[model samples]
Target: MSKISNFFKGGSSSSKSKHHRSRGTPSPQEAIHKLRETEEMLTKKQDYLEKRIEQELATAKKHGTKNKRAALAALKRKKRLEQQLTQIDGTLSTIEFQREALENSHTNTEVMKNMGYAAKAMKQVHENMDIDKIEDMMQDITEQQDVAQEISEAISRPFGETYDEDELMAELEELEQEALDEGMMSMGGLPSVPSGNLPSLRPGQRATTRRKVEEDDDMRMLASWGT
Candidate 1:
């Protein structure tokens, strides 16, 4: 375990960290790259240890009773390798968590910066505008619209001719009354009907109609004229 730690964070690591401190800090991208490299290295070590454990287990199985000492040694080595692999897994997990947090923080920082820039741009644009001026422009447009509507109404209305609706309706009623009187005079000039009491007859009608009597009289007059 100590050897693995020393291999990753040797004397050169201390010098590199000091240089980074002097040069400001490492970017999240660079940090993530280093973490991924470490993860890869640890994963390869895990594979090697797994293979050695399998070989040790095989050796233990093969020498069940005959070569117990050698088999025990192999199993002890395998146990140590397993413990180292477990520690590496824990370290890798910690590194991955830190890398992810740094990545998220970096993304948030860029987003905030872009939002700040947009806000500044909006402020600059609005600096040239006035709310009072906008209201005045809207008022002018409304007055123009009213003037246009008045002009349109004037163009569509008649120029010189205007009639009083009450007077026209009264004249029309007088013409209608004159027509009704003419119809009544024509009807009254017709011969008056014999309004005397009628002869006794059935409920629905007389035995011979008044039209039939007139027809008989006309026939007798024609015969007398021939004679």
Candidate 2:
């Protein structure tokens, strides 16, 4: 009975472990983060290996003529470090490729999700609309706009005298002719002033004398017209 109970307990534990594993699976972003971390670790390892390789090379050079065995040992160690560095390089490359691919896939998934939402929104917007109904509504709107414009124009129309263009032009010409005739008649009715009637004076008094003669001439002209 104890053996059977142990077997059942083991089975239940296995099932729980599987459930936990399923739940604990990392998302793509988390996986990418892990890959980046791994890449960074490998890069640091590569750098360390390269520095060691350089150190080995320097040691080999230093011991070249002095001790053949030491020089040979240094070269061997350098070779091993180089091989490890090469492996790290390959691993880093693979991790980087995987990270980039995952990032691209995640971006594509988000884009597709957003596009789906946009399509759904457009579908909803067009759900209650048809091409024929839309055209009819647009036509009704245009007609209403035209009606409104005509009503506005009617309301703003001049309520005062309305004259034909030709008649207004003829009347304007008659009024202009009357003004011109009045001006000419008034100018012609003024008596002519004798140029010799201006008093001879010095240069300094010339301006004052000219002004006085103009005033007198104007008075005489007006009196003669009145007579």
Candidate 3:
């Protein structure tokens, strides 16, 4: 019974160790490095095998029509080498495919990680923002701007000049009447000429005589009117 218990304990410990090891798998970069090493080894082997195949082919040709048995042996060796080269080619192709797949997977993982970070940043940016609050803020800003514009227009308006329409019209009519009276007085002060005496007067004296005669006639007419 003691021995059985000890065995079971050992088995459990071993299983736990194995689980830990399984969890600690090689990273993708390490795996790709190992795959590339393998690819290089296979490529070298393929080159060697191809060289061997060529050597055998040359040997076979050299022995042809001379020694049938020797030529047949060389051809058989070439065929075997070619087979090995084909297997190496297949192995290299598999290794390259695995390496490329690992690289693509690594790139995709990084891309997904960056996208997750971006999503987190965007979430943080929107965390404190409420749609209703934003709308209210915008409305307040618009109202303030409208008030400022009204104030600015008020400040810019013309100031201090005012007049009554009736007063201005009356003053304009008074000035026009004064101008007309002055014009009529100026016309009345000008001299007049006598009708029949104007032809007998000398040209130089006509203007002077005309003025004197006009004054005399005005005075006579005034005296007769008084009588």
Could you list the CA RMSD of all candidates, in the order they appear?
Answer: 8.4, 11.6, 8.3
Cα error of candidate 2 at position 47, Å = 2.0
Please estimate how well model 2 matches the true structure, expressed as its whole-model Cα lDDT: 0.93
C-alpha lDDT of candidate 1 relative to the true structure: 0.89
lDDT of candidate 1 at residue 59, scale 0 to 100: 91
| Candidate 3 pairs with clashing backbones | none
Which clashing pairs does model 1 show?
Answer: none
**Candidates ranked by lDDT:** 2, 3, 1
Q: Cα miss at 43, model 3 (Å)?
A: 1.7
Residues 1-227, model 2: lDDT tens digits: 99999999999999999998988978888998899889888888988998999999999999997999999999999999999988888888888888999999999999999999999999999998899999999999999999999999999998998879999899999999999889879898787677676666798798887899999999999999999
On residues 65-174, what C-alpha lDDT tens digit does candidate 1 reach at each position? 78989888888988998898899889989988988998899899999999999999999999999999999999999999999999999899988879999999999999
Kindly report which residue stretches of model 3 are placed more than 4 angstroms away from their true locations once superposed. Answer: 1-23, 162-227
In order of TM-score, best first, we have 1, 2, 3
Candidate 3, position 132, lDDT: 98
Model 3, span 1-227: residue lDDT tens? 99999999999999999998988988888888999899888988988998899899999999997999999999999999988988888888888888999999999999999999999999999998999999999999999999999999999988998799999999999999999889879899665455665356677798998899999999999999999
lDDT of 1 at 170: 100
Better of 1 and 3 by TM-score: 1
Superposed model 1: Cα runs more than 4 Å off? 1-24, 156-160, 164-166, 186-188, 191-227
Give TM per candidate: 0.69, 0.61, 0.61
Deviation in Å, model 2, residue 9 alpha carbon: 19
